[model samples]
Target: MRVSAKSDYALRALIEMTNRTAERAVSAEELGRAQEVPSGFLQAILADLRRAGIVRSQRGQSGGWRLATEPTAVSVADVIRAVDGPLVSVYDMRPESVRYQASAEVLQHVWIAARVALREVFEEVTLAQLASGDLPDAVTARTAHEDAWQSH
Candidate 1:
């Protein structure tokens, strides 16, 4: 359930790109500066996104970076997976692939359920909604709960 720094930075950079009106490519440096992420780390993230088909890179004077698809087609889950692998992993393995002893046999179900819970939100939100600041009703409803903001 922990969100990695790479995922956060990637989402921030993508959101910045989604908000921009310019048709020009966005340099890694510009994305890093705009999102307040480290330049080198951001470069690696951009590369990952490109390989994941979440983004496309251009070379030469007018070359930089851009989303490979429309913002609405790129969900938060997509960005997270693009930069950080699976949304949830049990010991770096898929939840269903993990085995547990009799005492903890039900733990696998918990992990699978957690993955589903994450998908319920992350997969439901897109870069367009995030960049436009017009979140889906389901997301807004979750945020409206006072308990959602308080740290346990």
Candidate 2:
């Protein structure tokens, strides 16, 4: 599954916020500058995140955006989904929505397995872990594999 730039920027913004004073709200412009995201695009992303209940916005001199929940409670998948929808899809539809003929029946299981594996990683990883640069043992092990870094 490929994450969109919007999702990536949203995640980066969240990570930046994690490193700041949680009690203080951060303006989109400030976040964009710190994260290197375009200010205009970051505003839209912040709105989407607000709509998803992942963030809360204030509207005055001291107004800005802040996480609605603790960083540890927000998964990477949550941020990605808020901005980009599902974690995995085939032809823009979920794996469960896709049907396969007898000749391709086994392929469905493969797709499902792939989706499950991805969820196993994304679902278990929270923004706190990422912002802290402390990954889980399973995630570290998977990335440590020689094949994990291969171009193809």
* TM-score leader: 1
Task: Give the Å shift of residue 97 in candidate 1.
Answer: 0.3
TM-score to native of every candidate shown: 0.97, 0.94
Candidate 1: deviation at residue 96, Å? 0.1
For candidate 2, the 10 contiguous residues with the lowest summed lDDT are: 15-24
Each prediction's number of clashing residue pairs: 0, 0
Model 2: per-residue lDDT, tens digit, 102-127?
89988778889998898889888898
lDDT of model number 2: 0.89
Checking candidate 1 for backbone clashes, the offending pairs are: none
- Candidate 1 C-alpha lDDT tens digits along 50-121: 999988998999989988889999999999998888999988999999989999989998988999999999
Clashing pairs in 2: none
The per-model lDDT (C-alpha) reads: 0.91, 0.89
- For model 2, the superposed segments whose C-alpha errors exceed 4 Å read none
